[model samples]
Target: MLAEGPLEEAVEGLDVEIEWKPFELRAEPKATLRPEDPYLPEIWKRAVYPMARRLGVDITLPTVSPQPYTRLAFEGWQFAVEHGLGDAYNHRMFRAFFQESLDLGRLDVLVGLAEEIGLDGPAYRKALEDGTYYERHQDALRDAEAHRVQAVPTILVGDTRLEGVPSTAQLRKAVLDERARLAASVTVEGVVCRADGTGCA
Candidate 1:
């Protein structure tokens, strides 16, 4: 939530394509944290809510205890992407979890969210039920591991990587810097020389 606003402003009218990837905070067999847990509330109070308030994004600590594992939800994401509704699916998922307190770990809930975004509900449900996208989702997880993603909202612009929620100015600067680097490389390669090769030096 905190990253969304700043990210939107930073990439506005820029030739940037945002790709949302899977990063499960509590991947299976690992237990999901409960709001009753001191760690959950402590971090939310200290960091999340303050950042949300500053960014003017509406987000809350979900009350779902023993929160659901996200493997199934990410599988649904693969389905959504195949149908060209990937971005919408991601936005709805975030709203469902953080805002509506909906359980994403449930197949029925996932189908409902998919249907809400005009995806074929039955097809999505069948895909999840039969584990059709399971391997695909696993492949995505492996990609994330290869990237060594240690935090959420990790933005990579050229060689500049911003972990956690970055300010709009910081994100904008990284993007501009990357663009400048690409432009410089292009300029060097595009230099013209005389046919005689006298100006090649």
Candidate 2:
């Protein structure tokens, strides 16, 4: 997705929406903590952040919450990735929790971030606690599994699947191709209308 700027631009006028999908963060088997292991948060900052900005999408990683129906983990990831917030926010949260050793799963931290970004912190926090988006998250996870996405940063460009970090040229080509196909199928027309159901130019 990050690699296809040209393609996206080529089809900019067409009414189309790109959907991003994120992978689940399964807990690794317990092992002795290695100080030398690269921090997950830093890795994301260095790798995923820049590309995500270029792609103009967000990524979301849903952690287990105490809420009820608001557990839309997978869907949240998709939404985050689509909105380009996944890397920026998630990386920050992950760093706070894993590297800096802060509790990222806490409501206060999440709410703080929401506030910082001018999102509805209280509402979003409540949703997390209440599991308001749980179904969507679960559904997204199922979709990811069905698509065999076993890693982070998977790019789904139409029928083409590119996994891991892709080059700029590759991404650009994909975007262009996607736009071309969409443009080929749809045509725009102009129409004038009056409130009284009478049409005029």
Candidate 3:
């Protein structure tokens, strides 16, 4: 949601598919953030959180106890995307974590958001607790790693990978270029097929 420029223009005509990839937390070998620094949660609430809300829908917070299994949960969320549930949960979870400052790593928080969004809270919680989507989540993580997505807000524009929050112009250019490429690769008959059996029209 950390975006610049016209939102509609940035997303217009884009065949973008949203996925919530697992959050990877790697230890910073050279640390810069100190306890004296401003609280990131508060900062997010004041700035980034609001921006995210304006951008799209928010989703539920997960139960994060004992330790933060960010990778597992994020991958699970991404599986939801594969099954076409990304948009709904993404919007909810983002709001809860950034805007509401809720602990997204908790199951109760997740349940609350799910209930608010009219999802079956108990069923969803059971799924998470029982690791119902474990395999799917793992597969998503593998895919993300294969694509070298080490950061959030990574945009896969056709074969191009843009990491971090991209500018409106950059996103627009990517979208346009992708469209042009698709167009060029297509045939007038609208049934073009690749000799390698990779594409069809």
User: Stretches of candidate 2 above 4 Å error?
Assistant: 1-16, 27-103, 181-201
Tens-place lDDT digits, model 2, residues 80-118? 444456645555544444344443445676667555544
- Candidate 2 to truth, TM: 0.53
Arranged by lDDT, best first: 1, 3, 2
Task: Point out where model 1 deviates above 4 Å.
Answer: 187-201
User: Model 3 over residues 1-201: C-alpha lDDT tens digits?
Assistant: 354233346876666544345545432232322223456446556755565566553422222222233443464464456455666776676666545656655677777776676666677777788888777766765777898878766778789788766667887888888877776664547776644555773
RMSD of 1: 4.4
Deviating ranges (above 4 Å) for candidate 3: 3-8, 13-68, 71-85, 187-201
TM-score versus the correct structure, for each prediction: 0.90, 0.53, 0.67
True-structure RMSD for candidate 3: 6.5
**Top candidate, metric TM-score:** 1
- Look at candidate 1 and tell me the lDDT of residue 15: 94
